[model samples]
Target: MRVVTFCDIDESVIDSKHTIENFQSGCSGEAQIAILDINSIFDFEENKHEACADKFTTIAIVEDDSDYDAFKNFGIDAWIKADDFSDINELINLIEKRLFS
Candidate 1:
């Protein structure tokens, strides 16, 4: 399964570099992961093209409860708290379950 991480650049704990690197390192083999900044998506000029509509599984890293409604409304499969998970493996497991099950 392909995993994509959508994160807010303004968030203190999850910066652009960390978000990109974490997604890259987390999805190492056959499965692929891409990290995209939420600002890019919101900016039409920056994100000229839309993500593939058929690629359904997406995980958004949210900093607070307020962001949950918007992310969920966008059809994200899951919302993960960056500070909560002990490791990437736990996040991967959630992805696996959502995508495969």
Candidate 2:
């Protein structure tokens, strides 16, 4: 699956175990999943918003509990803490389950 992320994820955490693909912002393509790290960016462009809307699944990463409510208007499918997961594989597994199950 083609996975895109807006944050500067530590790819090394998952690169050895799984192949992670990332697409740049404003790219025209269908993505299986899109991860938005709100901790890094509070807001994005209209095009990026539209792109995430087209994604099958969209996960938002936030730093605080109040951040979830702040991003509620963005049509986010799910959310996770910015530093909750130690490995990208865990995040990937969570997304897989949420998307498939």
Candidate 3:
């Protein structure tokens, strides 16, 4: 499976088994999953996340518990709390469940 990160993120959060790509201006491609950092893209263009949801399984990284609830209804497939961001194992497990289950 291929994953795309919509903002500048710590690359190590993803496992090496899956192909990973970073989004850039004017970039075009397909991805099984798209990860977004809330701090970076929460206030992005309206409907941007909706458009992503149509094309890829979308996951959001949030600052804390409050963030989780705040972004819950925004059309994302899943979320990762801030404390879990650096744990690759957790990231992998969450992504797997969201993508495959």
Pick out the ten consecutive residues of candidate 2 with the lowest summed lDDT. 40-49
Compare candidates 1 and 2 on TM-score and give the better one: 2
Clashes of each: 0, 0, 0
**What residue pairs are clashing in model 3?**
none
The candidate with the higher lDDT, 1 or 2, is 2
lDDT of 3 by residue, 1-101 (tens): 56767777777767777777766542235566777776645543343543343456667887776777666767767677666778744665666776666
TM-score of 3: 0.66
Ranking by lDDT: 3, 2, 1
TM-score of each: 0.47, 0.65, 0.66
Candidates arranged by TM-score, highest first: 3, 2, 1
- Give the Å error, residue 11, model 1: 16
Residue-by-residue lDDT tens digits, candidate 2, 1-101: 45566676766665454434455534434556666776534443343544443546776877888888877887777677767745556767777776656
Query: Clashing pairs in model 1?
Result: none
- All candidates: CA RMSD in angstroms? 7.3, 3.5, 3.5
lDDT of each: 0.43, 0.62, 0.64
Backbone clashes in candidate 1 total 0
Shift of residue 91 alpha carbon in model 3, Å = 4.4
